[model samples]
Target: MAVWDFAMPSPLHLCRAFHNSWASWTASEARLRIATSASDTTPLPAEAIHAPPLPPPVDTVYCSTDAGFSGPDRSPTFGFYVRSMDGAFVAAASGPLACPYDPLLAEAMAIHEALSWLQEHNYHNVQILSDCAVLVASFRDAGSYRSYLGIVLDSCLRLINSFPACSVKFVRRGSNLVAHALAKHVSAVEARTVWRDSLPPFISPAMI
Candidate 1:
């Protein structure tokens, strides 16, 4: 029997190590038994006994929208993202130079861009994530839209309804950095029309 060292740093590494050990045992005449030593009978520390639960992996996509001002008064940029469960890029968008002082309008434009990008690729079952409460709430209640926002709200609703199983969820602002960053990029580049699929090199780092 071969005595293998424990304390590997990664689960994948540990799996490979154990598989190799088992193979080695099979080739040898001796049998292998995984028994703990007497000192190992002591209870593990609380942190060791209970591993932190990982964030739920989602086939899940994330989208974020951000608003920026062109001249400290006119908000010009809006950006959004859509990612797969392993955080691979799916769809993304930005509406640069919106020139709308109303942040909600900028947010709506970003949402519209994201939806249009998704629709082009025929993505139906999706969960649109955002940090904009007003925009998300508008989807939940018919009354959330009023005046100009009413038009934007109506457009968003129509886009969402076109898909069979789609939902808009509001996450905390802290969780929406990716989308917000895209929006800023849009403004800086002054991009016209919509962007899709391609992601900036910097954004890929945070991705799983």
Candidate 2:
């Protein structure tokens, strides 16, 4: 049987053991720091994101126009309404055409009437909206007219040029309900009628 003796380690062996232990502890600490940094930088879920804000509303008035034609012999009537930027009714006008009856001509005349009315009221900055797409397109393209209605278009262009700021736009029929209602209500009229700071009872419901 061989006898086993327990002995204390030499200083050199102790120093080597201490160095190895310190290196192992430092490596473990560095790994922990890296893991913590990666967790902190993780991306958030899609639902946690936020969207940018919308821009503010524009500062401008809106005027909508429409025309109603009953028959070839009957005169066509037009209606127009001006609203503030916030859509509060500013003024309204409706009347029968003094010119010969034609649907396209009636639409152009309607716009002319509205522009003339605004010009008379000293409204420089104005935006004209119509349910008639062709009329709006003609005005946008600044086309010259040669037909019987050429004079009427020229008059409308002159009125538009008088304004310091003016624009013509085409809108959906549903959006021009008030103007349509006014046109239909005044189809029997033989003269021009205007309402300022007040709306007619017939178009009151449609204003909503």
Candidate 3:
């Protein structure tokens, strides 16, 4: 039998106490491995757990329709701008016409043209930002448009659905300056223009 002194125990005494308790519980190899791992910043080779991949980031295209209204006798002109995902200049289109159409209808038609171009040019997986909440909501609802709006709405819906997938959102009018400026230009004149590859000098800086 070993006689142990408790009141005057030294450092060796405490070490022996810990060893007696843990020596039988853990294998000597495990203890050595734990010590080696604790001193190293790199973990053990087999300890790493694999993680699943994440989804790709979303892309957005901001578009706005501006219906330029003149006096009672004139037909309102329509213009639109499509900005790239990072707000860079993409393209713009505008036209002047005399039709007994409401602003909502004109907005819908402008969106229709933009989407048509997108489909024709093979742009897929996009979110559309607009300033016409009602027009967007109408597209989402799909079945509640008024009877007189049937032709244009149907054409627009078909064009929209033909995409890989597109989302419609409304933004502030102030944020839609490029399209509004184009609409103002079309309203004051009697011409139509479709811009691609580059934008006119005046509207280029703001778009970028």
Best by TM-score: 2
Query: Residue-wise lDDT of candidate 3 within 48-79, one digit each (tens)?
Result: 45544643235556566666665565566777
Q: Which stretches of candidate 1 lie over 4 Å from their true place?
A: 1-60, 73-75, 97-99, 186-189, 193-198, 202-208
TM-score of predicted structure 1: 0.61
1 or 2, greater by TM-score: 2
Model 1, range 11-75, lDDT digits (tens) per residue? Answer: 78778999999988776634322243444578789997798875543444655555655555554
Worst 10 residues of 2 by lDDT: 51-60
- Candidate number of the best lDDT: 2
TM-score of each: 0.61, 0.66, 0.62
Q: Write the per-residue lDDT of candidate 2 for residues 1-208, one digit (tens) a residue.
A: 2233766777797889999999999999999999999989978777566655643235456889888875555768898888888878799888887666677888888888889888888887788889888877776545567786777777888887897777788998989998888787744366778888688877667454
Q: Rank the candidates by TM-score, best first.
A: 2, 3, 1
lDDT of 2: 0.79
lDDT of 3 at 137: 77
Candidate 3: lDDT over CA atoms?
0.69
Worst 10 residues of 1 by lDDT: 29-38
**Decoy 3 TM-score against native:** 0.62
What C-alpha lDDT, on a 0 to 100 scale, does residue 130 get in candidate 2?
A: 90
